[model samples]
Target chain A: MKKLNYGIIIILGIISFIPLLWVFITSFSPGNQVIKGGFPFWVSNPTLENYVKAWETAPFIQYYFNTFVIVFGVLIVQLITITLAAYAFARLNFKGKHVLFILFLLQLMIQPEILLFPNYQVISQLGLVNTKLAVMMPYWASAFGVFLMRQTFKQVPYDLDEASRIDGCKWYQTLWHVYIPSAKPTYIAFALVSVSHHWSNFMWPLIITDSVDSRPLTVGLALFAQSYETGAQWGMVAAGTVMVIMPLVIAFFIFQKQFVSSFMHSGIK
Target chain B: MAAKRKKFGSSSRHNLFAYGLLFPSFIFLTLFTFYPTLKSFQLSFYSGPMTRLQFSGMDQYKEVFSDEIFRKVILNNILFMIGTVPTSLFLAMYLAIWLNKKMAGSSLLRTSFFYPTIIPLIAVANIWLFIYTPQYGLLDNFLHLFGRGDTSWLGNPNTVMIAMIFMIIWKDTGFYMIFYLAGLQNLPRDVYEAAEIEGAKPFQMFRHITFPLLMPTTLFVMIVAITNSFKNVDHLYIMTKGGPDNASNLLLYHIYEAAFTNWDLGKAAVLTVVLIVIMLSITAFNYLYLDRKIHY
Candidate 1:
């Protein structure tokens, strides 16, 4: 039975790894070798030419810049908005709290991705189209972030809040010293999830941004790959694909445990 | 009277502070979520371009429902959901059960299964696009070993859905596995030991004990997987573009085409409303299930 379990896992593992492995291989193989291919599994002569050509073929530097600005830009704002909103939901009492909370939940369901058309209109009307801010704006208020943080904040002992209040700390001060510090793990978890999410986000960005100035790696890679379709530049496409995924993939490997647990935390919450 | 007024004033101040804290989130949420949703509802009733509008109640909705492409897209979306969600869930649970045990190389197995989850769907599409390409593609190259001829998997309507479904399962199975692994860790061990003493088989223990206990996790995973089915259409943008006569088209992709490609704001509005309705119903179902799970 133990042997059989190992066998099953080994086979499935190989299956999962095949595409990634093949793509990695294709990215390294020479352009001529790829064009001459019948599944070129190994490279007799590997080269960095594809990567060079892929970089030249598109303004990948600008795409990388745009992606970083958008991902962190969205995360920084989300951290603030979600923190404040989550604190209110977790601690304070206010009028229409129930109704407002339900309204917040509506964002969780009607995510901005599905609201592409209407959101585009909003962005256009606000004269923010074709800007990184356009991609970042709709996501500034993340319902999932608020929901996650609220769950964490609610777990803080009531005594802490009272103690801070007795010390003459204002509500925000209490939140800063008491709630935020204790909820460090939740903050990390939310940041990890949010960063990875916005890093890979495509459709809305694809729709809103027109030029390379604001297009993230995903959109840039898509257009770059599509441009090479008739030419069959699989090697360059693979190279561009690798460049787009490498940062997240490498970070994921380094932070494997954190990434796994963060996702798990999100699920459980 | 002085003390009561002080307490009342403090309570009101608390309310004001709370509202101030929530105001920022509400501003963005109202702009992006609430306003867009209400706009979609209103626009669905109007049948023209953005510049000129004539309110024609329910006409856009009726037209969208009757359109062949819209119906096809809905069916395809449902089919994609049916194909991807359960298969991935089952694989996830099965893999999680094995990995949950103490074994060497388990971390490797975990990484193998979970790595694809982090790779952007767009990149996954690019990788799989090469694999599905005819003649020189990986799958075809492998098939040649078994004497099969070259085939265009994505180009053929009959094969496109299955091809797409298989890629999606490969991409998502490990993701769902993490949740099940978490669920498995929280399961009581004593019950399994009790079942073992009674001479219950592994399958029987799973069916009778583990399955029953993990019901909440399964429900939660199901909601995520189902919503994912609606949301993740980036692959369609890369591979099929709802091609082969719109065989693999999905509702969100259809909405994209309606709104952007066709430049039909009215139709797009109607489609968006339909998507919203579908999403809200799923949330309603999830809440009902979650409420029940709390008592259970």
Candidate 2:
């Protein structure tokens, strides 16, 4: 029975790897021979031509630049807002704090998709449509980030805050010097989560950005794939897809343990 | 007397600082999130394009109830949630358990399972679109090995939702597995040993011990899964566009089409309100029923 269970697991693991393997092979297949399949395993005469073509066909470099701008912009703003909000919720004694915090939590409960039309209207009103800032604006203050950071902050001892206060440090100063420094792991965890999420974010960016000047990788790839009317040229699509994902993939691989643990920490509670 | 006055002033100043710290987030939320939500509700009562707005009272809601496409889209969304959530959850838990054991190359297996999670949904949809192709796609060719003929996985109206469901489950189960794995890791080792000493069989242990302990994680996973099933529209938008006769159209995608494609802003706003109410009430219900039961 144990042997059978292990066997099933091994089979499942191999099955999980197949789609990625297929993509890798199809990416390298020479020419438009992507569909000539006798098990996509053996790519006879693989070439780098598809990669070059994929690169030249689109403004991928611009897409990358736009995506980085949006991702980092959102992350920087979110780190400040969430940290401060979390600090207040965790340590402050302001009036109606609990009620206000609960109201903030309601954002987490509501689906972001439901807000798309209205958010679009707001962006249009701001004259931020077709811009990277439009993509970055709605995500500036994340409720989930606040909640996660608040939880992390609560775990730190009160003595540290008291000591800082005794030293005549103001609230913001204490937050910067003590609370933020102590929550490094939480910050890293949130950073990874935020970066990956915004990197893969599609629908909002697609809605907000009109042209290649502001389009991110996902939108760029989608438009690129759709432009191929005769179905996706598997090699080019795969190559393009790989380029879109490789940065996050490499980051995950390098920080596999941190990534997994962060996911676990954020998810389980 | 001097000390008392200083304390009062300092305390008031500190209160101001606390509010100051919270001011930016509240302002952003009010402008971007809360205001839009309220405007969505308000806009539901009007029916016109960008400039020509007219009040229609509850006419929009009435139309939503009577519209055949709206009914179909709601049914399709529910069907998708029903199909994907349980399958993904169960498979994730089962695989997570297997991977949690002391096994060689477990990290590699975990990474492979998780690779799909990191890939952008648009890209995944592109890859899966090829896979669902009738002749050269991996799925059809693999089925051919079992003496089956070519199948139009995405093109057939009868199979479109199911095909999308299958791809969704495949993409998400590994991601869910990470949560289950974390839950499993957090379980106390001694409890399992105690169950074993009490002569509990594997199934018995799972039923009486493991499942009970994992309930919180299960609940979290369920809520997240359902919410994701509702939010995920990119695949449908890219691959099917809720097509093959709108057989695969879910509520969110329907909302997108209504607002953007058809330019029926009022109807789209109505749909958005209904979607929000449904989602919020469901989440509220889940919280009311399951929140307190969450052990952690």
Candidate 3:
């Protein structure tokens, strides 16, 4: 039974990895060899031509810059907003605090896609359409972050807060010195979740950004593939897909423990 | 300073500070989350102009319900959910249990399963778009080894959703497995030991012990899966674009098409209203039925 379990897990792992392995191999393989695909996994003649072609085909440099700006911009703002809000909910006693937190919970059920029309209207009204700011604006505050932080903050011992406060710390000082450090795990978890989310986010960026100037990597990659110009260029598409996913994929490799632990922690939350 | 610190908990000044801290979040939440949700509902019943909405007394909702595309989208969403949610849930549980033991290369296997969840669905779909490409794609190429040839996976209305569901399950099951693993590890071991002492078979132990204890996690995963069913449409854009007569078109994709492609914000508002109502009912179900029962 134990051997069988191991076999099942190994099989599942192979099934999941096969597509990933193929994409990686195909990205390096020459276009002709990919079409021939009788060779198992490895290419007899791998080339960097597809990567070069994909790069020249799309403004990948600009897309990468825009993606960085939008992703970090949203994350920076969200950290501030979520920390402050979560602190209030976790530490402060106030009128309607519970109600306000409930409101935040209610937002969880309301997927952002449902608000696409109105958010677009708001962004356009602010004259921010077709810009990276427009792409980042709607997601600047995250309810999930607030919820996760609040839960983590509550788990923090009150003694820490009192210790900091008795040391002549301001209320914010207590949060900064005490709550923040104690909730560092939660912050890491939230940051990972948030970063990956915005990194891979396509629809909002696709809808908001019109040009290559503001288009993030996902939108840029989709258009790069589906422009019908490169529609049949499988190798190039594989290369572009690799370029887009490489950072996140590589990050997963380096921080494999943190990444998995973060998901587990947040999921259990 | 000691007195001041002690007074910090309930003082009116602390209340003021708390509100100050909350102000930034509330403002953005009001602008993006609360306001847009309320605005969507209001705009759903309004028509005639974008600048000035006139209350048209259910006309927009009526039209949205009558929309053939809307019907197709809702049907597609149901099919997508039915195809994905239970299958992924069980697969996640199965993998989590099998991988839970301390074994050689176990962590490596877990990472392999989860690797897809880290990549963007759009990028994954782009690779899959080629995989499903009619004659020369990977799947067809693999199938030819078995004497099968030339299937148009995404281009066909019949197979598009299945192709999509397969990719999606592959993408999600690993992530969900982590959740179930957490749940499984948290379960008390003594119950399992007692079950074993009573000569309980593995399936019997799972049926009575593991399954019941994992109910909370199941409910949580179910909520997440249902939400993902509606939320994830990135692949739809990259792979099929709700194509071949809108067979694979889901609700959010239709909303994107109606609002963006057709520039029909009024109809989009109507669809948004439908989405919110469905979301609300799900929330209600979770709170009323599932929340009370969850052991946590």
DockQ of every candidate structure: 0.83, 0.69, 0.71
Which order, best to worst by DockQ? 1, 3, 2
Question: How well is each residue in A1-269 modelled by candidate 2, as lDDT tens digits?
Answer: 87898788778778878877787788888755765567667887898887899999999999999999999999999999998888888888877787898889778866455678889999999999999989988888888899999998998899998999999998778888888898999899899888988999988888889998899999999998887735347788878888888898788889988888777677745
Tell me the lDDT of candidate 3.
0.86
Would you list the clashing residue pairs of candidate 3? none
What residue runs in model 1 are displaced by over 4 Å at the alpha carbon? B293-295
lDDT of 2 at A250: 87
User: TM-score per model for chain B alone?
Assistant: 0.98, 0.95, 0.94
Error of 3 at A217 (Å): 0.8
Best by lDDT: 1
lDDT (CA) for every model shown? Answer: 0.92, 0.85, 0.86
Q: Which stretches of candidate 3 lie above 4 Å from their native place?
A: A228-232, B1-12
In model 2, the runs with Cα more than 4 Å from the true position are B1-9, B294-296
Taking chain A of model 2 alone, its TM-score versus the true chain A equals 0.96
Q: What's candidate 2's DockQ score? A: 0.69
